[model samples]
Target: MSAILESADIDRALKRISHEIIERNHGLESVVLLGIPTRGAFLATRLAQILKSLGNEVPVGTLDITMHRDDLRLRPPRPLLSTLLPPGGIEGKHVVLVDDVLFSGRTIRAALDALGELGRPKTVQLAVLVDRGHRELPIRADYVGKNLPTSSNESVKVSLLEVDGHDSVEITGAR
Candidate 1:
């Protein structure tokens, strides 16, 4: 375990995110939540629950952009990718894209491509738990839980309760 965010702190962070999202949009109507693969999916689910509790009938789903990633060959081959297209798709809908961390913004780029194949969305806003500040693309999240300053040699690991049995973020040095 590295010295980083604790489980309780993460829970609080997510709760803050949920609140901010609702506040920024001024109520979730005709809203849709779409997530990147892995942790993004978990975050989206939680946000959906929060919206539902607030009486917002927002739609939620997951997106897998494994093949669409720009670093496809740079990283290990990721088979068994999931390309889930929403039931009604995103045509003219307000879609909120969720991801665990915002790094080079390449992942969001790939997600946009994958989203394009499904349908056109009226608006697509990004929501991330952490923004580590070193973007390579022209993208910035509309909603961010935390702005964590980090070095290029560092790595960020976000653990969620739904899968990791804990909610926290770990920053580790590249070894």
Candidate 2:
């Protein structure tokens, strides 16, 4: 069986996360939102907008961890990947990494490695639209839109208005 959350719910979740970020950071300055590409990129932009609405000036960036992934040699190769470093290196700034879903945590590991190549940041935290558990690494999101307790055989799919023409989160069995 599959479950869905309406667009309104999604927006509320994002706004909550944004508020949490601002509160935890004691306000925003020299902060960056870097998405993990694909769905994460869209979510990152949305988060940036929310922060901006809250009167915070923050820069958003994108990252491609395809090559830095440990499973790169095992999984199908991804092409046209871009690992553009932030115009301003992460040093002395707070960086919040964004992703659509949190699963085995391997993706976060890869993204961390990719970030190292770019530049060091004063701090790095995670923000995910959905957290499905079953982490294989010691990682946790600082701000999560939703905590979805799901099975290993299932997956959380997040569709954003910018990329999917809709806004919602769905859970379905893995094919």
Q: Estimate each model's TM-score.
A: 0.91, 0.94
Query: What value does the lDDT take at residue 17 in candidate 2?
Result: 93
Please provide, for model 1 over 1-175, each residue's C-alpha lDDT reduced to its tens digit, 9 standing for 90 to 100: 3747787666677778777778877787667899887899888888888777767767789988886887778878878455565677789988899999999999999999988888889889999989999999999999887898999989998988888887789898865
Best by TM-score: 2
lDDT by residue (1-175, candidate 2, tens digit) is 4556779988898899999989988888778899888888888889989888888878888989887778768867778465555677688789999999999999999999988888888999999989999999999999998889887987778888888898888988876
TM-score, structure 2 vs. true: 0.94
Q: Assess the local accuracy of residue 98 in candidate 1 as a C-alpha lDDT between 0 and 100.
A: 94
Which model scores highest in lDDT?
2
In model 1, where do residues sit more than 4 Å from their true spots? none
Q: What is the C-alpha lDDT of each candidate?
A: 0.84, 0.86
Superposition error at 144 for model 2 (Å)? 0.6
